[model samples]
Target: MTSNSTTYEGGCTCRQVRYRMTAKPLFVHCCHCRWCQRETGTAFALNAMIEADRVELLSGEPEPVMTPSASGRGQKIWRCPTCRIAVWSNYGSAGDAVRFVRVGSLDEPDRLPPDIHIFTSSKQPWVVLPEGAPAVTEYYDTKKTWPAESLARREALRAKRS
Candidate 1:
């Protein structure tokens, strides 16, 4: 767990937009799905999942671009207008309540490592996962994988939905 004083700052490539994370991410995911590869133009997409309330804008506003996803509901990618760098995404499941932050956009990308690797069935053969890291062929059950606090937080969100 990150200390309360520990904050993360990040911005777009052109530095047109800036944001801050007040707390540690609830979880980080290294997704190797084909859709992720096509969107990121890379082997995988490293995303740090956090509540939208935790992300505070410090500078320029990012534009949300709707993009197709494997889930069919699509996702809204928040990107810097000038640099066109994707800072984060809001999936349909949680809408804007949660943000899937692009870890690569972080000032200290190495600070938060992937808590789990998903969609490994389609992963490139050469990309090796770290030993002992939690990995699965597809998405895992949140009840079985997510931390207790995260589950509780999700429950609270669900309660609000109802």
Candidate 2:
């Protein structure tokens, strides 16, 4: 949430796969959906959303593994081939244009905390969201929640598709 550097570096558990983000993330999500719980083997998943183009591989290449998701279309999780640690994922909605980077995979994960908590309808009963934190029962409208700069960036990307 608070960092002096625009760029951030991270990699797999073994440190074999390294990558850098050229810019700060557009947004961060604390997802509590059942699918996320199952995939992460935890109560929730912390993901930093950003444009895929901004992610640069500094060392090892990640293998994109096809995986099932709440959406039938599925997603591709880019993981370190050797350590098998998932670094990021490309969902069906944005394809490869956007990446949901696993904050846990970051060297300084604390630098980017969840901007919003999503899919709380299916969240575990034991889990309690922070007081006054932005949360929603399901996915949010990016136009309403995303920062102005991020919204403009997204709009520009959409314009290119047209």
Candidate 3:
């Protein structure tokens, strides 16, 4: 488990849009849905889900690009204007309350591994998950899967929005 003080800094490939995560993310997801694979052009998209307030932009601004999503509600993918590298995404369900930071964009991407793998039903046949990694065909209930601290943090954020 990561400490609350843990911080991470990252940027786009061109270094035009730098940012920092002030604390550990609420959760990390490795999504293997077809939409993710096509969007990222990879087997999966690894994201660190955290409160939007925790992400601090340190450099150039990222332009939000509206994109179609599996939910059909769509999502906003923040990408660097220079390199057009996706840095993060704000899903329609969570709106602006949360940001799914791209794990691959981090300076030390390996530090935050996926807490769980979702949409594994559509995962590429060639990709193999770790022995003990938490995974599900679709999604998991946050109440049952999320750590207590993360749940509390999410509740606090919700309270603020009220």
RMSD of 3: 2.3
Off by over 4 Å in 1: 1-5
Better of 1 and 3 by lDDT: 3
**Cα lDDT of model 2 by residue, 1-162, tens digit:** 225588888889998899888888989999999999988899999999889889999999999999898789898999999999999999998889889999999989988889999999998999988899999999999889999998888887777777
Worst 10 residues of 3 by lDDT: 1-10
Model 2 — which ten-residue stretch has the worst lDDT? 1-10
Instruction: Give lDDT: candidate 2, residue 83.
Output: 92
Q: Itemize residue pairs with steric clashes in candidate 1.
A: none
Reference-based lDDT, each prediction = 0.91, 0.91, 0.95
Q: Candidate 1: minimum summed lDDT over ten consecutive residues — where?
A: 1-10
Ranking by lDDT: 3, 1, 2
The C-alpha TM-scores of every prediction are 0.94, 0.95, 0.96
Please give the distance, in angstroms, between residue 134's alpha carbon in candidate 3 and its true position after superposition.
0.5
Per-residue lDDT of model 3, residues 126-150, tens digit only: 9999999999999999999999999
Per-residue lDDT of model 1, residues 1-162, tens digit only: 233445888989999999998877888999999999999999999999988888999999999999999889999999999989999999998788889999999988999899999999999999999899999999999899999988887887777778
